[model samples]
Target chain A: MAKRITLPITDEDIKNLKAGDSVLLSGTILTGRDAAHKRLYELIQNGDSLPVDIKGEIIYYVGPAPAKPGYAVGPAGPTSSYRMDKYAPTLLELGLKGMIGKGARNKEVVESIVKNKCVYFAAIGGAAALIAKSIKSEEMLCYEDLGTEAIRRYTVEDFPCIVAIDSDGNNVYETEPIKYRK
Target chain B: MEIRQIKAETVTETVKKLFMDCNYFIGKDIMTALKKSFENETSPVGKSVLSQIIENDKIAANEEIPLCQDTGMAILFVEYGDKVVIEDGSFEDAVNEGVRQAYCDGYLRKSVVSDPVFDRINTKDNTPAIIHTKIVSGNSIKITAGGKGFGSENMSAIKMITPSYGIEGVKQFILDTVRTAGPNPCPPIVVGVGIGGTFERAAQLAKQATFRSIDSSNTDPRYASLERELLEEINKMGFGPAGLGGNTTALGVNIETSPTHIAGMPVAVNICCHAARHASATI
Candidate 1:
């Protein structure tokens, strides 16, 4: 059974979750992808303040298509998480609570997930149209010049995901495949 | 021989329709493969994921929206008839204009950047599509086009192996690439292996192989068998649907081969995600 949880996930929420637990996330989350992450990393390096608060936020790595009429966002699915591996540790250090994306993370990002008591969720890759239904509203927050790769805030309800890596660093990408491997 | 004068605007309109239709509608071959994989998939999670993908495709088609967000950089494989000539403009410009209109008017995302290494700026309208054109001996132009999302494309690889490396070398390289790709390219991926070509030709053939329908296999019996064997081996990896775990890692393995130099044998593997958006038209 999938656990129903709200966003701005707490450390206790992270602790109780294990790798492979199906989750339905509600409430609000931040969106950023490769270009947005690069800008955020630059700001952190130069000791500049971030445009959006990172504390207790779950960032979704996605660059959604432009919505048609009567839509919040268009066909928004998670991008590959590994692309943001270089920047994820820094965000985790700033008290980011969780991340939603597809694919595996690097060693450093996985370690940071453990250290910072963060969780990594994997939304089904390529399931963009179905996933978009969960996003109820979206507002551009920063990096609008980056276009779809801009940073935005999304209000989501019952967004489906799996805990790919939990706070203790149990990673589904490593363990689950082993079980089913012939 | 009579020249078939094709209006440049005709080409533009055809290309425009192809892009929009390919983005909005998941190919029938892919939809069927997904259904078959869903029934065969052992993992409960994999089954659920496949179900969602199936539903997503149907929704995108009915709602007339893109099946995936990446909508991909535009790619067209054109077989231009030698006896056909465009009336008003160059074939290239007409095709780019088509891509521009489809992406902008159809609401597809424009993912192309002005440069790769530095100053990567979005092309905005998704113009300057990557087009591969061949002059053939016919009066009509045949175009096979697809919107190639990069999640799986980034996992593609190519290598130059000697003739001494033989068939075993080819198999090993294909398997290694898929293993390395694992879940990253999105599971139930379509693996396109191009063998026995020069470096760049191999890569192009690999990309072309991806545009081939998953319902089909290579023409040669030996290559077709190899395709089946590779698909089996890949499924054994258990990356499954969404790569969480299961029985079906790849929906299909397509091998397209060409005769090569005596000493050099190059192989390229182009992995494509399940969306596999491709459409064809003859004009």
Candidate 2:
């Protein structure tokens, strides 16, 4: 059975996350993919204020499709998180609590995550339809100009995801594949 | 033969409809690949991911939703029957018309960029669909299209004059590409390998071959055998779903080959993650 965890997720809680554990992330998570991160990192460089207070907040690396008129957001899912590796260490330094996306991360970023008491989660890629059910509501926080790459705030209801990378530097991607490799 | 120059407006309208339907329908070949993957996946996590992909397809179909968020840059393979003539205007224009309407009506995100390097501007309309036109024998036009996203496209590669690296060389190249690709391309990817042809042609073939049904085998026995072997090897890498580590790094391996210069073993590998977005129409 896949174990589920609620959000405002603690380091200890995320540290315990294994590859197979099914996590239900419920909290005030932020959405930012490549473009927003570029801007956020620029803000860091310029010492500017972020559109949202990211301290202790989780960020989902996603570029959601355009939502229908009445919907909170469109088919929202995580984009590959590694593209932000160069900027990730900077974000981690700013009290970035968690990241939800798929795929692996660089070793340096992984170390920063461990050093900064951060976490990384994975919502099933390509399960956009099923994943959309987790969002109870959403608010466009900033970067409305970036289309799907815009920054937004989300309220999730037992949003399902998995912890792919944890603080101990025990990456599920590295360890799990070893077990399965013939 | 009915001489009908379909209005650019009409062609455009029909293409958009094709986009909407393709996103929801998981093709037969992809289905076969999933089944095979589910059966052979060694890692529990890998099996689970494949299952999720399968379930996602079902959910999209039943719920009438797009299968993946990256609905892709709409690409069209238009086969105009030699007898059928479009009277209204340019075939390309009609095709783009279709893409614009489909994307707009379906509420799919406009992901295309007019400029690749600097501007990175979203074209908003997802306009100027990539159309590859080929004329065939019949009267009706046959359209096959897919929404291709960045993750897998980023993983695509073309190599010219790679020497007789033989089977091992090819295997290493494929693995190396995946390793270098890391998580960007999206793991548990479907790799379409196109061997032979000029560099550009190889890459194009690789992309075109992606539309091939997943379970279909190459007519060449050697290539067929290699495809199976590569599939097993890729799974052994244990790249699992989203590279969180698992037995299923890839779902299947497909190879398309054509005669080429004796000295040049030009090859291309195009990666399509599990969200294999594709649909076809016979109009």
Candidate 3:
């Protein structure tokens, strides 16, 4: 059975995770992508007040479609996280606890994950409709001008993901290919 | 000489429907490939991931939602018949109108930014599609339209190899690109390899190759063998589904080649995600 995890995860929770562990995450998480990360990184560099709090929160890298009449948001799937690598370490230092996205991260970002006692989880990259079912509620936080790249808060339930990088900095994206290659 | 007059509105309507339908429906060839991949996948994690992707596609089809969030940039390939004439307006305007209607009416995401460099603002309606036109010797206008998501698109590559590099070099380059891409382009992916032609022609052929049915092979026996070999090699690398690890790394590899200058062998790899949304209409 997959392990179950709750949001605003503690360091203990992060430390227990190792790369390749399937997890079901619940509770609140923030959403951002390339544009939002650039803006947030700029704000930090300028030493200006951030629009949203990052302390002990997870940020999902996604840009979803516009919601239909009844849905909270449209199909919300994880985008590639490597584009955010340049800004990730800064966010980690500011108390960001976890990140949910897909694909590999660079060396610096992985090191920051270990140093910050944080975890990186990967949702299925192409499984947008399936993933969107987990999002129970969503509200815009800031950077609405960025359109779908805008920052928002999402309340998810049992959001499925795999631990791509753990606090020990063991990265599944690195080790898995070696083990599975024919 | 007989001229077949086709109203611009008819072209617009056809294109709009094609884009909308392609986004909602997974092509039969892709669906078949996914099922086969699921059956052959050795890893339990890979198998389950494939199942989820299959289920996700079904949900998108039945519920009328998009298969992936990155609805992508509009790309249209127009094969204009020499004998056909648009009665009301210009050919480019008709194609753009179709794209605008499909993106807005179908509720697809508008991902086109106005400029590549300065002022990278969303075009809002996904207008000014990347349309490539070729004049052919028929009376019908054949349009192949699709949305190309950038997640995989960004992973694509191009190289201008000297004739001395040969086929072995071509194979190695493809292998390197897929290996480096790993899990990023949303495996299992459809790889489109464009060989020969000039630099821009190679890139266009690579893009065009992605729209072919995954089950089809190149007409030339030599290139078909190369396609099969590349597909086998890619799957062996074990990027699996979502790169979590497994044998089903790539679904298909389509190669399209044209005669090129004796001095240069331009090659381009255009990677399309499994969603590979595309539909064609001849009217």
Winner on DockQ (1 vs 3): 1
User: Which residue pairs collide, candidate 3?
Assistant: none
**Which candidate number maximizes lDDT?**
1
lDDT per residue for candidate 2 within B81-114, as digits (tens), equals 8887677688887888778888888878788878
What local lDDT does model 2 show for residue B88?
A: 68
Off by over 4 Å in 2: A1-6, A11-20, A69-71, B1-4, B182-184
For residues A45-101, write the lDDT of model 1, one tens digit per residue: 999999999899999999998899888888899999999999999999998889999
Error of 1 at A52 (Å): 1.2
True contacts kept of each: 0.73, 0.69, 0.74
Model 3's lDDT to the true fold?
0.92
**iRMSD for each candidate structure, in the order shown:** 0.7, 1.7, 0.8
Give me candidate 3's TM-score against the actual structure.
0.98
Q: Per-residue alpha-carbon lDDT of model 3 for B1-283, expressed as tens digits?
A: 5889999999999989998889888899999999999999998889999999999999989988888998888898889999999989988898899999988888788888898888889888889899999999989999999999999999999999889999988998888888889899999999999999999999999999999998999999999999999999998997899998899999999999999998999889999999999999999
Q: DockQ, per-model, please? A: 0.85, 0.67, 0.82
Quote the lDDT for B196 in model 3.
95
Sort order, lDDT high to low: 1, 3, 2
Best by DockQ: 1
Q: Is candidate 2 or candidate 3 better by TM-score?
A: 3
* Better lDDT candidate (2, 3): 3
- Looking at model 1, the pairs that clash are none
